[model samples]
Target: MKVYISGLYSGTSPQPGIGLSRSLRIAYPDATLVGVEYSNRSSGIHWLGFDELWLQRPWEELDLPAYGQLITELLDGGALWISGTDLEALWLASVFPDGHANLLSPPAVGLSRITKPGVEAHKGLPLQIPPFVSTDHSDWDLHAFCRKHDWRVWLKGPYYEAVRTKSWDQFEAVRSALAKVWSTQRLFLQAHVSGYEESVMLAAYKGELLGCVSMRKRELTEDGKTWAGDVTEVPEAFAASLREIIRDINWSGGAELEMIKDPEGQRWLLEWNPRFPAWVHGATIAGCNLPAMLVEAATGIPAEKTTAQSEEFTRVVLEVPVRARYPLPPLPEPYAG
Candidate 1:
């Protein structure tokens, strides 16, 4: 089987994509991985074992037709695209529909709900998001949210890139940077909710829960990505609440809810990941293998429940020398069911 994966760029690293490929290999040993890098400059293009590495069109150039043609080529090659980024996931959820149903990911509705404005509008609900405003209507109106929250606001791009801006000047700088990256998309101003970060990863189908695992971030880098973390228990109360939100949204695939625990011990939903998180390898090793589960669902194959591993995983940086190899056949998987 051929599986196409994207996320070649995940904030100064490509571990996210490589991690997915590694997980996929663990789940299905015989599967061939088709890595999609938006740029040839992506360093992970060197990480070994890709059956094929295709440089995809830049995100800014992906219109319906361009994206559709790309999909056709992939499907014709018998490759299933596993989204690496929310942008790609949204496009797949919107375009392919049943073709990629095994991903069991959120539909367009669920995807839309995770956006900055969507999170802002749903504040005070089960997730209790912090106050936020988009610059859609007016910049002046967004500043009001800053005054109301009186916190350092995060100037965020539509998909990625978030910069903490306490004053107007810094906001402008990040805004200008985002414009160059994600043109034609709106920028959002989010109230900085003070708290330590935690995340819950889940795999569900048709509004019913399969299983889930949660974690607390112990160490983080400047970009808010978890560097070191330990697996924690999933709170029963929080599980019940997250289930309701999933049912309400009719979510159909893997998702990660990033949260922040405030001084009062209340957790606010900082972000909703419609697809698997970058640290998903941690989840897979923990026994809640979302990639394997997703592949099972997508392929319509029945599989028994698997056990989880309890522990922590630290993100480590390393390098490998590329070696020359002749043309290779499809990758191998042990349980490519």
Candidate 2:
């Protein structure tokens, strides 16, 4: 069987898809791994080591008719798409929910029920959402918010890009740049509570929790990503909350609950990553092999034992090879999003 995996950027950089390709291939050695990217030169194009690579139109330039044809071809050829980037995941869920066979994921609209500003609006779920206000980032009023709450605040974009700013100037600069990066004019001005960051990564199907691995950050890169972390078997109560959240959403995909634990030792759910995060390989090494299990759940293989081995990791940057395919086509316009 074959599947298309988006976000194949080389893993050495602080980018998405770092661990995805490696982990997925390790889990399923027989399947054809097709890599999808907007540009043929994307580091992932060379380093993904996929069986095939397909260049795509820029997200903004993607004509609906053309994308539909591409999807039809993949489906006819028996390739199911499993998203790796937040953008692709959102697009698949929102734009083409029933277009192909999906193993794990909620419909795009259902995903928005929890991630969008109003968690209370999502019925049947009791979730503690962080206080946040949406802004267009045009008339940014950094001082007023800082005066009301402390100087700490998290500036985020619609789908990706999150930065914690400690000063008015820093807030303005970071917010301005990230807005363009994520291709959204709006931003989420969120209350930044002081706490240790933790993540609970899971694989589910039809709201059923197939497997889970929780981790507490041991160290972070200067850019504020999980650089090193240790796996911790989550308490049953917390695990129950995770299951309830998924069941309520009927979520059928890979997801992560990012949280912050305060000095009082209470955790606050920070944000929900719609797809697997960069550090997903940690789950496989931890004995869950989530990506593999994800494929299994999708393919109906008798599931492997989802064991929680005590695994810890130190994420390190490394180099990858770059090669060009024959009969190359002209590169697409650079993506501004």
Candidate 3:
């Protein structure tokens, strides 16, 4: 099948798109692969061994019409389009609302449903949701909310994006920083949840779970603080419970479940990421290549059999690499020729 992979950039290496491309080449040696780069730097070309490569200016600068037209062109030619970047996926979901039919259903449904609130209101279910009070000001009550929750709560964006804080003063400081860029009224608050974090990455088709892997966080960082951690497979019972949850939600494509372990040793739902997780590279190394699985799901091919072995004691580190660029000294002022 013809597959198109888009969203390439110079700083995209920390993501698993390139690694996914390499894995796809190994798995489907004969299938045609197309790579599209969205930047002028063109660093992705060196890694994505594709049958064809297309480079365009970054998406932000492109006119909506041009961007839509380009996407249509690519879709018209390829049987499957794997968005190698989150922005591309969001763009597709917005511009070509029905275009995701080419993909499996779960992820598409999750994206469409969770992008906005009020569709489903919290009914006070026993789910581990942090108590939140909304205010007109994006920065309103952030400190009070944390204080009410005993100096710990999660600061959430309109969506599930979370920022954890330990004190009302710290929470207020975060709100101040965000207020510089975003209106405080746009910010919301949630009670902070304290527990071990675990994630389940899975592929589903027609509400049936096809493949899944559970991982515990080996490390976590927020606000410049980092903690070391490890990932292990979810026990069979927990996996089954999470699968049922996915099925109940009528989820269809690629998705993940974030959970926390309470002091009682029970798993509590943390949040659901309708798309790929940030640490997808870890899943790739653990024998589940999410991008390839997504491609297979899009094309109606069964996901490759994944070994159910956990790389226990396997330590992984997420590091930010910084590089300094030196500029050339300006040439001598023009000498009269």
Candidate 4:
């Protein structure tokens, strides 16, 4: 079987494509692997031995007709595709209202409910949603809110970006900077929850929870992305709640629920990513291959639920020898007088 994976970049802030590609390779060594990316700067394009590489137009450059045509060409041979980034998956869902069999991604209808401003309204999840105020509300008392949280709060953009601010001045500065950078005023503030970080990674298909793995962050990059983690067992109650969530949304594909567990053991839902987390390959090494299970579920063969064996994973920088495989571009001819 052939597989197409997107988001193949790796760095301080890595993407999930390379991890998924590696996990899929471990499971199906002979299967054709195709790496899909939007930029030549994606480092994984050359390091990983993918059977094929496809570069496409950036997200903003493609319209519905163009995207539909791209999908048609990619899945022409009944190949399965798993989006490795949340934005691309959300965009695909928007463009293809009916969804595609060969594409594995969360349904668009339920995405908003699990994302930022909308997640606050999502009911039935066994977690606390931190109180937040949107910038659109000019009447909000910023000082009072900061004082309530003991001068600690997280400033967040509508889609992706967060900064922790402890004082009124810091809050305003961060708010202004994020607004300018993201080019929007739709920012929000959530009181910081003092706790340890953890994430639940799971795969679902047509409302059925196929498999899940819970892990706690042990090391993080400067940007707070997971750099090392250890797999932890899911409590039965927590597992049941996860099942209910999948069934409630009729979610299909992989997802990661990021949360913070406080000293009182209360879990606060921080974010719900529509696609797999970047550390998914760690789960593969720990004996739970979620990428493989996702592919299997998409193709009608449901794999058994998998739990990770007791294991830990960490990332380290490495250098690989680079060689030019394709012919180099011709040198410009000398200018004639």
Q: What C-alpha lDDT do the candidate models reach, one value each? A: 0.70, 0.69, 0.56, 0.79
Ranking according to TM-score, highest score first: 4, 2, 1, 3
Report how far off residue 156 is in candidate 1 (Å). Answer: 2.5
Question: Residue-wise lDDT of candidate 4 within 63-176, one digit each (tens)?
Answer: 758776878776666988888887788777886655677778877765866768448324666788888878776635767777888977898876567889887788889988
Indicate the TM-score of model 3. 0.69
lDDT of prediction 1: 0.70
Give the per-residue Cα lDDT of candidate 4 at 242: 78
RMSD each, Å: 7.8, 4.8, 6.4, 4.6
Candidate 2 overall lDDT versus native = 0.69
For model 4, name the residue pairs that clash: none
* Candidates 1 and 2 compared by lDDT, better number: 1
Error of 2 at 124 (Å): 8.5
- Residue-by-residue lDDT tens digits, candidate 1, 184-235: 4488888888888989888777666666789888888876788878876687
Which regions of candidate 4 are displaced past 4 Å? 118-122, 166-184, 301-310, 323-337
Which has the better lDDT: candidate 1, or candidate 4? 4
CA deviation > 4 Å runs, candidate 1:
10-15, 61-67, 76-78, 97-99, 102-105, 120-125, 136-141, 147-151, 179-186, 206-208, 301-310, 323-337
For residue 138, what is the lDDT in candidate 4? 62
